[model samples]
Target: MAGENVLVAVEGRRLQLSNLDKVLYPSDGFTKGEVIDYYSRVAPVLLPHLAGRPLTMRRYPDGVDGQSFYEKNAARHAPDWVRTVTVDTPGSSTGAETLDFAVVDDLPTLVWAAQMASLELHIPQWTVGPRGGRNNPDRLVFDLDPGPPATIVECCRVALLLREKLRADGLEPVAKTSGSKGMQLYCTVTTTAPKQAWGYAKELAEQLAAEHPGLIVARMAKNLRPRKVFIDWSQNHEYKTTVAPYSLRARERPTVSTPITWAEVESCREPGDLVFTADDVLDRVDEHGDLFKPLLRKKNPPKLTALKSR
Candidate 1:
């Protein structure tokens, strides 16, 4: 491993072989030896968070033609923890690798995403926006997806309007870019406990969908959805997961998860717009700090319940 070629050199570090890395990263553009080398530099920054949890890794190869994404495994052919996942990049042949590391559940998934984004200088974005979480309480998620030909400014307006709606409901929502097209508004609350969150998400989603017809739709049943943005509650399950922040999604060009401010969000007009990168995101960490930490400090045990009539 020490003598292998280097794929991504970051100066000083050590590498250890992990099953997740072997399957996700593979030996595509770089050989098994080369991957070990890059791992030497990256593992230290990544391991502390990865310890004790299972991970899902994705790999990218360099070529003029473009990149390809492959999941490590699937439940049908492999273990529950290791799986290959890809993002939907409309009309593009080459997609980027999307990796996630977690013990198995939403809270850890969220924690890993926030830490990875802050550590690797990447922005985190939620997709197929939903409101359910097994480890977290039921809440709302507004996915700010990029349109086929939409601008960041339009997305921002959508988010601010969402913010207003959430406030009207007396929910304190946290906003963040999905690292790709649009943004996500997560309503914070106690009780990350699974079923309760799912119930809450269901009621909230139904309420919002009914009031904001055309603007939102309940996405529980896939076959019915067409052009509307889905308020997905499926992500609330204990085993379900989303791509973590800072993980390079397999695309023609590697796009990382990015974080943005509500003020910055107000000034934008397109989904493909942003001013963050892996190297500059730490500055964001310093300025805004981690958004998930406050939840961990609470001891007031959550009183989880749906605002809507069950």
Candidate 2:
């Protein structure tokens, strides 16, 4: 892990990288250089979703298998040019405190984060808003996580069902692999109210779980995770974060959270169908532009509470 420094200019920005040859994914022998290269290459497409969001960086200083830590507060060492957003956090019992979170405003900052050996990027459902305005969730996520003995295929089936329900509510939905063993579905939200998204998602999840008892579980209880897939509605909260699409995972191997088409979701028959490595994801982006872009783009928000009126 002890290596010398190598200076490089990233888009005219100076960065000194160390231990680029350090193995992060020892199982596949993928080095830190490969991680940096992957983020740098994917920055153009990846940055849009990350534009104004506070990033909870997952740094793998000793690689994926080794010691890893989540960095919420921007490092004090960060250069002045690196943009950050200060948001209020619920502290103690009386009031709130501010946290300075890194906002990857440009490709230079993206590469610099890679220089820190941050293997994964996770962003909240909402952005920091213009001029760091009110934090609200612009989208909602339904994380279909399967229990043991079940896999991505099961989650895929459940995702399709969730998609249909969201579509019925007059909202278009998109599906993506979680880069690990699970899958996530996203829908563009119109409400700026902090609780609307979570309320809608929780209601929908409970309704579905009630409609299909054995196959689904909406509650976040450990005992409920037997041969069932959990619809994680809790991700819709403003304080929570979901894995950024196209971000790398800290799994045993370097897998990416790649977006998928609806047809791909329909044809997903097994776990392997949902997996994409860093190289595979890069190739996919080259062939097809970002399909998950709609979630972050301006769109009409559906009155999810109206669905309850039915």
Candidate 3:
């Protein structure tokens, strides 16, 4: 069944999907079909966060236990219908000045990526403008990564503190699990430069580290991270990308980067309390709707300048 293929119609577009029975998560026996199904069910909410943004696919063709690669350029064999944006990359690691990135704006595109085993979808905080220009970041993200001896419970404490700091700056932040070992906090911004967001996040992270020495670590140095959560403020950089919420992570199981409520964060006492599988996420969406919708609002987002005086 490895080479088995099935042709299906998605939104009137025909896609030749192959290896639906291939296990992408060996630990749980989760298959490629399940991955596509998960993306299909979550597309209504996930697509908005991905629209107009160039995506970087983390492909695990063989499975989570096998080799994986980060794909920034769109595949040459990609369907003609797949939308792509070509952007400049001056550094030229591959000796190419620009790369064509895929934009997963619809259900068919999402399923197509899933068929290729693109389990994780990553995107920058910025979006592509109507004229195919890169816009200033519309959101700020704080990726709370736990060091050793630390876990999601510790990340929860740091998230609570970040929520308060962001709120005081007049921005409403949402929390989501990293679907790995930590979590992230996101807040909307309006016309804020990337440098400004980076500086603001760094300042707040350092301030919290100083105030809560035992619970947080602001520096990226691995030695300083033990027993503390590292506030990855650097993710605000223009070129950096965070895993899109609702996207599945390449873990042994089908764990998803899920949006969560503050109440759950407040009550979390163990690491397992925050872990959510693909099925778990679908149920949450059914019950609570999209808690991360606030980040998608385009109007009247708080400006980063409000925190300049602080």
Candidate 4:
């Protein structure tokens, strides 16, 4: 696939783009071109984090509210130059199946995905190694989902508490808005295996919940976590994926999963205080650069010790 119906040359690579005028977000009147433009502008910092990590696309062919689907297979229409990594999927009665996930490594591929109307980009904690070798967990994620009446503000409080605990354990953690209603906290940890990461996260969450029953709930069942923000440490597992930082969420509007400073988190009194749109994120990148970049290039891994068993 040399080139076909090229929209324009993106980073010296001719990319065929489509549906530039389609209004993806009817509420906000956001068009497909805007999404492509946002991805293009953020590509410099975003690409490094996603270089080896395969993406699970949350495709909104029509819009955010319209029917959408999560796609694992890179479309056959994708250019042969576009890279793909095959991953093993859990088996059923039949057997296991191999799935190909897109590895977004450049501006052209990012625009190509945006052209497909991929609104929400999902990535796993671990990244696939070179030559289809073993994958390793590079980042540990905690997805904070607040229950009714417990807004993003509450999630921030919980994140702050978790952050301190992680700091105490010699880990440097950071927080970001999930671009939806919640918040996500991440730390660069020494754990390379997904199972090890998952177990460590489980232990941390469970201990925290036990320490602060009124504030945090570590349980996964929705029923068990009434009036409490659930610390979804389960995202550390092998199969699950978290929203890639700096990605636009498929919300009512184009909200971005913007990286934030700890001071901002502490001062945020309202949930909307930390909410950022696509334009806001672009401005942030221009001013502050990649706040989440250090996580990818951390020199020292996090230090962890056995919990006291709360």
Candidate 5:
């Protein structure tokens, strides 16, 4: 199966895909072909969120039960048609000052990445400028992680509180399941410096943690997180990335980072209520038509500066 290949044409591009029968999710018996199919169907909505952003892929060459690695540098053997951007990585661990990262802006690129078993695709808040430079972040994100005794139920509570605060600041927020143990909140913003965005998120998180000391933990200490939600504001950093919406996570099953409605968050009573599989996501997309699409609006988005000094 590993050596077998299927040649297909996608949007005038020819690609050779392999190992379609290989089971990537052993528990679900989900194969590589299914993974590609999922991406294909979801591409219409998924591509906009990924366009022009540098991507960090989580690869599972041997399946979810096997070893995996993060791929920041585009594969040397990647097709010449694959677009990439070389960015500076100051104080690099591998001693390279810069890395060439893949930009998945089209359906063909998405399929090729799936063929390599890149189950999770991670991206930052900013998009690359037309001139190959980094633009200011156009969105801000809050990664709400739950500690051991805590779960999505608790994350939902914190999310509701964040919604109130964000709305008061004139910014609208949207919710999404992390496809792991927690959830995330995203808000569109006028192009703002990453440092400013990070500062706003950090201050807001600390403020909420102060108001609801028992329910939220703004700091990253493992001991402080017991039975509380850790509002990971640091994800707003320019170099940091959050899982792309609709991306499959490297979990025991093919869980997806799914966009959700506020009503669902308000009524979430158990962790199972928020968990979504790849199949579940496809169905929801057909019904909801990209609930997170509001984040893509470029007109008159609120500025993060209003809350920075609060």
Candidate 6:
């Protein structure tokens, strides 16, 4: 019993009903109470982990297949603060029914979206990003990304190693899944000239690659990294786009870009071992607060700049 209100439509006619606290999602229905329950359970773990910032959750209806559905509707609900955009959809639709909400705010919104999209529609999985929401950030993506056969553990190791090095340079590094087989390392920096940002990231990545040799490969093209992780700098460009923050991808089981703790990184050996579902992410969010908040505050978000040289 979160509350009472259901905005519905009948035969092309809209109807507003009172004392209706239940949400009738095509995949699964939830009452406002359920959403609130999840929030209370998860917020504690998620709040501290955030980069000391407010979170912006991307709702994927019916999982990744429902990405387009969400993207089309996101414009209406997304707060005015988002900036960076990336999508993790598998490029397909779930082919399921959908419902709409007028104002889905706060952590409750996340629980409702996950339950409805994942449980109700049965889409594959979901991926997520930091809650810069419109003002989030256009990350300087160093895709030290590896391909199949690369264990998640190995990828995470590379990420952690990079994290240590980046921290020494006064840059905060936050890691997330590529929503595929690799990991993405995002560093928050001041809105220096775009060239400065790109130059800083490129230099750092290239230096790391040189230090690791076989373990780290710095190449712009995918073909170059037949088996190694490529440090992609193109994402650092101002106009360049990554996946939308909460866009879903077309995976059969529906996974999300859930956060991982340094403890998990220290203990795990493969990325596959860390796959997380929509039902489980909020708990982690509660545990960690926001991992990207430190970096976001250190660096003043993204800014427009002329392209810089390598």
Of 2 and 5, the candidate ranking higher by lDDT: 5
lDDT of 2 at 56: 83
Better of 1 and 2 by lDDT: 2
Task: Report the C-alpha lDDT of model 2 over 1-310, residue by residue, as the tens digit.
Answer: 5497888987888888889889999999999889999998998789998888898899999998889887877857577788888877665132537777899979889988888888899998888776777566778899988998889888888887888888888888988999999989998877758888998999999999998888899999979988899999999877788999989999999999999998898898888988899999999999888989887667567655644776
CA RMSD (A), model 1:
9.9
Writing each residue's lDDT as its tens digit, candidate 5 over 97-215 gives 88888899999999988988999999999988766699888888999999988999999999999999999988899999999999999999975565888888999999999999999
| Model 1 segments more than 4 A misplaced | 1-54, 61-155, 168-170, 220-228
Ranking, lDDT, top scorer first? 5, 3, 2, 4, 6, 1
Better of 3 and 4 by TM-score: 3
* Off by more than 4 A, model 5: 306-310
Candidate 4's error at 276, in angstroms?
0.5
TM-score for each predicted model, relative to the true structure: 0.56, 0.95, 0.97, 0.94, 0.97, 0.56
Candidate 2 residue-wise lDDT at 200: 90
- How many pairs of residues collide in each model? 35, 0, 0, 0, 0, 58
Candidate 6 lDDT over 164-190, as tens digits, reads: 876666555667665556656765544
Q: On residues 197-302, what C-alpha lDDT tens digit does candidate 1 reach at each position? A: 5666566666767886655566645544444555565555434444443334333332445445666777674444563433345555556665433223335533
lDDT (tens digit, per residue) of candidate 4 on 160-222: 889888887777887889999998999887764558778878889998899999989999787
Q: Report RMSD (Å) for each prediction in the order shown.
A: 9.9, 2.1, 1.2, 3.1, 1.1, 9.6
lDDT for model 2, please: 0.86
Please report how far candidate 1 places residue 54 from its true position, in Å. Answer: 4.7
Candidate 3 C-alpha lDDT tens digits along 146-212: 9989999999999999999888888899999999999999999976565888888889999999999
| Index of the highest-lDDT prediction | 5
Clashing pairs in 4: none
lDDT of each: 0.43, 0.86, 0.91, 0.84, 0.92, 0.48
Question: Which residue pairs clash in candidate 5?
Answer: none
